[model samples]
Target chain A: MKALCWHGKNDIRYDTVPDPEIEHGRDAIIKVSSCAICGSDMHLYDHFIPTMEKGDVVGHEFMGEVMEVGAENKELKVGDRIVVPFTITCGECEQCRRGNFSVCERSNRNKSLADKMFGHAGAGLFGYSHLTGGYAGGQAEYVRVPFADKTHVKVPEGLTDEQVLFLGDIFPTGWQAAAQCDIQPTDTVAIWGAGPVGQFCIRSAVLLGARQVICIDNVPERLSMAEAGGAITINFDSESVLERLQELTHGKGPEKCIDAVGLEAHATRSLDSVYDRVKQAVMLESDRAHVLREMIYVCRPAGVLSIPGVYGGLVDKIPMGALMNKGLTVRTGQTHVKRWTDDLMNRIQEGQIDPSFVITHTVGLDQGPEMYKTFREKQDGCVKVVLKP
Target chain B: MSYSGKTSSSMSQSLGTSDKLARGIGWFSVGMGLFELFAPRTLTHALGMEGKETLVRACGMRQIISGIGALSDNPTPAIWSRVGGDALDIAALTPGLRDENPQKHNVELAMTFVAVTCAADLYCAQALHKRHKYPSSMVYDYSDRSGFYRLVADMHGAASDFEVPANMRAYPPMWAEFTPEKESGLL
Candidate 1:
């Protein structure tokens, strides 16, 4: 099988690897049809998340037909098309019962290793890193899906791969981000980062009935996409996010804020961003918290801060005083993908939203290495890249 | 299944030729700086400029800073700095090339190496700049991509049917008085 393998920092390779086989009764083998390079995958590509080994297959957002199924897995059979959620869950755990699927207690096989790092292991994630169980990802011709019976979302016949593929990750992720805001009809939602997840966040906020939506990003292409999705766009490069947000919300900060940009927030235009870059370069900080600082400083008092961004390891200089005094509520976690996929899939089928709008580039899986660089650099108007495996 | 006729050998790498060159120069800069810092007397004696060890050490520090910058995620600025340092190196070496200096040939050789490295730095810097250049027209119009089947205006609040899960709700029961349903008398 040919897969995109992580070689090192900023190095992904199109390599030939052995075929995946079912390792458990709940496991299934999928012949992947489509996969995407997620923004969080950039963390691994940049070598930020620790525990990634050489030659690890690198992708999670994928959908395909089941080519083989385990005997005890009655939920699916051969020829059943499904989108594999990034977070592997056991469905029987207490967290899964409470709809907190991302933290399902039994999914992570390397729980003790993760316990040493995160205090408690959350869930086993596909291709994220060893801290998340180190399972091989779906950016290949085929993949072995552990706990496949409960970890899959069945795709209907009518939808295209591009329309349904994101159900496994970003679509549900963005939906979860907006849902966490508990958006009221009178609320104003301000989102940072107009990347793919950020784009979906803009649309999700609009769909869920926020009175106004504002998106902040430095990339013009992304800002344009955000505007199309009904967000008032702010280019942090040319104008002030804080000042414009203040003016748009009539001087009272926005009622809800979302940080879609996570660890590698672009280091530009602000003194804090420069400070983050210096700290990151010196290895003093593991994750950049520029967006977090900006969101906390500008959010309305007692407002909700929903974060869907991926942050690894320790972050320095968070404004704890402001966060405490303002009485803000912070909601953050990996998306419990199953909790929202059914609703989002219905929306897709009902002609409410099309996930394909965010895909700006598509190519063969062999071009995965090049596309990683293009997507990371945001070059050639590349907003998102989908690989046909 | 064979997805592509092209094999791994034919695939394009994330690090292009110029990027690899910049990395090479960055390491070379570090190596050169270390030599000048720890063994400045060796360079000074070779060039017949025995009393200039301190100046060599200072130049070494500059090289190290520039090298670290060159090795960073965006190497264009650091590469440009190296070009500037090359000019300084040529100026500093010119004094050692005087007719009275016994090791003027070694100084000339060092100047030649610096000139070659300076050219490489300039080329790499320009390539990186061009690679990272933003599009001249700031915005690429994606206004048509509303992601909705109907007009975006018509799609606003389309998913009002969605109930925020109990654990995720922002406001308490007392705050329901301010809800849109209550405001519109629908409650």
Candidate 2:
């Protein structure tokens, strides 16, 4: 089996690795067909994520055919094409039982039974780093899925690989982010970071019935995608994001805001000072969307603010009191991939949502490095990049 | 055949006798460390917050001296995001902490160290900085040694970048170094 790996910062290579075989009774080994470069792959490739050693396999989002399944994996079978959820949950942990499957007990491979047994960092992730668990990522030719019965979301036979790849992580994430909001009928929604995840959050919010959808980003193509998704778009570069968000919302601002952007926001890291860190943070954070906060500040005092944006461990200051005082409800977490995969597949099959609408390019797995470079730069119409193995 | 026989490793490795006992002890130590670091409110009933802080402060300096400890760790980019993003409610603070009362921050290695987001970690950082005030950049960082990567994978636009990996398997708790070039796709 061949795997794409991150040798170091800006370093990626395709290397031959071993084929995956059944290791746990609950595990499933999938023969890879397709995988994609993700925003996090950019983080890993660029080295913003920290904690990785050299030659780390650098991907977790993927879908494939089951070549084998452990006896415990009764629900799955050989030859079933499925999307691997990014998490490795046991589906029985307190978190999993509560629909917080991303933090399941069997999720991370690096963690020994001595560790929480499942998760890394906040919980575990595939091929992320040794800290979480040194589990191999899924950008290879075969993947050994832990706790497969809980994590692998089956893709319908008729659907193309491109249509459901996002379901593995992004679709569920976006939908979950939308569900986190207290989206009353006719409520308005504002989203930051018109990146792919942001784009889906925009589309999914509309699908979930927000009266108005507004998106903010500096990228033209992404803003165009938001516009296509029927969202009023804002480019924070030329105008003031705060002014525009306030003006557009008739001073009440949006009823709910989502930070689709995660940690390495769109600030000048290499070109600027350490202060660039602050700028990128705020830039990617789309402070105006904290209108989730402002919704508390400006809404009818009973409005909701939902944040699906991801954050790393041990974050610095968050205003917990204002969130409390405004009588606002703030929701955030890793998406429960298993909870929605079936429904998302059905929706895709029904043509209600083609989660793959965001994809812009498809290339062979051998082109991963260059495609990663292109996609990470958001170039060549690369909102999403999927690689066929 | 065992139920886990469906899992994908042929190595047939299982926990060793010593490994199982060590695992128990490791969990106990981890629990003790968490209690010592996080449960000062409870631990204080037995040992006291003052004692814990003193011990933490002393041990922190030793960790620094021994090259394994640090007085301050780089806040994750997420924490930096929360602090810088106007999303942070500047008003919610322990009185004059946010760039207001310089004295409350004076014994620390720069007042900004107080800016970490989570209250629990802030307390930890505060106790250490209040004592030795070492200039080491990160008190802790994300790191890992046991390597794991899935042989196959998929992702989509709706997904986030950094978080999805944890959904699959345990990862190292340490953070990876940031690559500015790779981030912007310049590389």
Candidate 3:
């Protein structure tokens, strides 16, 4: 059962495959142990999500044990342990009865190929491809999962699959991009990408209160893990992330931006990331959204941008006149990770923040193709790798 | 009272990296079908379609017979023959989206890279035809599963009236010290 497949743009092999079982009836079969390599699996290892295939497999965070189940998985059993998440909900639809389990609508059995490209079609993630329901992931020693008592959670005992393997997706996508910036107490926020979902959106915008976070990034160990999670960094290649977020928010700017860097955002000389890297190297744009047009040219006005960053296709200069002349709002999707993987697994059981301190490398599942090229070239200091299996 | 063909619970399992992404899109359809069947006038002036060499060698013999039917080995009919050779390379690049093709934006960037490789060959030929529609030696015999056991037993009381709120249960990990040999002794 080796796994980590993907094979294309920068390939990814560690192959050997096949093992996952319980093909539905509320499937189960875990056994994985641990897994990680995420930053949106480098958008399916650089082929920026064209519904990956060529030996798909890959990963989606992970956790383990349960080995087998399906008899209609009554809240799972065989060995138990768990973690799972990476979307795939079915906790009884109507958007999992309003808690919006990542827009469930019956776990995407490739929901008309992501409703013919994004027109609506969400849940069903694990391994993230086939639009979103080709399942088979958790960088394998087993996997399967599906439904299994509504996409797993369990894990109880004294935690540590690197403290609940990121409740299966960048700590519930940096705590749902800082709890959709409802953050008030005095606000501030900002974010962008200091990697590993901007170090869990700088410790979930200081555990959802904000008061000041900032972040941005050019990488010095992800702006020193967003300054050890207290934030206030920047470095967008040396200052000027909209003039150092308007001199650190003293000019009424970051009331809550986020954008955790999606769609391969990398710009050195700007001009709209060199016209989104020559319209994404020729095929005229699929998405680059220079930090969503600089979070609509610096948030604040009405604030709350959010994003959670993974983005896939078609994006060309989006500012919509500063989101309708400074009244902003935005919010994004893909992270209904069972509405915040159980209060971020009780904030990793009360210690509040330590998601394996952005793991900087762990290796094993055959060193998943060299820890996916050392976590997509953020090499050596590789902000988060994990694997294990 | 129902059963004739495709069963093993209506398929969907096959995953050896989806037969290596349908044999790496059937050897990239036999290397873009032998460079558009023997370089049809240098692959129609390198995809800008100059006098379409006999319709690019008839779309390079349907991409070398769907790149040898996606390099054989049951990848759902070679990922539906590379989704019918990506709809015949978008019907031969839709006549260079007309306007007398003076490289109509290089035939709209070669039909937007063949509509993003025909949406990655129609998402890996509908995920290898919905994973070989159930029959990888069917196991669970859910006795012809009565509508998936009445939709997970009527979504178990609406998944317990939408749970997730035991005062956001902050430190509940005690299942007999959640074992995996004490989580591999905290690794």
Better of 1 and 3 by DockQ: 1
lDDT of 2 by residue, A273-326 (tens): 244355434544212223233234543344555566654432333456766665
Q: Please give the range of 10 consecutive residues that has the lowest summed lDDT in model 3 chain B.
A: B140-149
Against the reference, the lDDT scores of all candidates come to 0.89, 0.59, 0.72
Give one digit per residue, the lDDT tens place, for model 3 in A1-389.
77778867656777687677787778888888888878888777778788787888878888898978888778888898988888888888787887778889898899998998988888888887898878878888888888878888888888778867887788788877777666655778888888887777766666655567878778676676566556678787767788778888776688778888899888676898888877877888888888888888888776768798988889897879888887777778877787777766765675555577666556567656655654576645567778776
Clashes within 3 Å, all models in order: 0, 97, 9
- Residue-level lDDT of model 2, residues B32-140, one tens digit each, is 4455455544533332223335454433332223221111122222222322321232232233334534444432322243343224333333432332222344221
Which model is ahead, 2 or 3, in terms of DockQ? 3
lDDT of 3: 0.72
Candidates in order: C-alpha RMSD to true structure = 3.8, 20.0, 20.1
- Give each prediction's DockQ, rounded to 2 decimals: 0.45, 0.01, 0.03
The TM-score that candidate 3 achieves is: 0.34
What value does the lDDT take at residue A60 in candidate 3?
Answer: 83
Worst 10 residues of 2 chain A by lDDT: A285-294
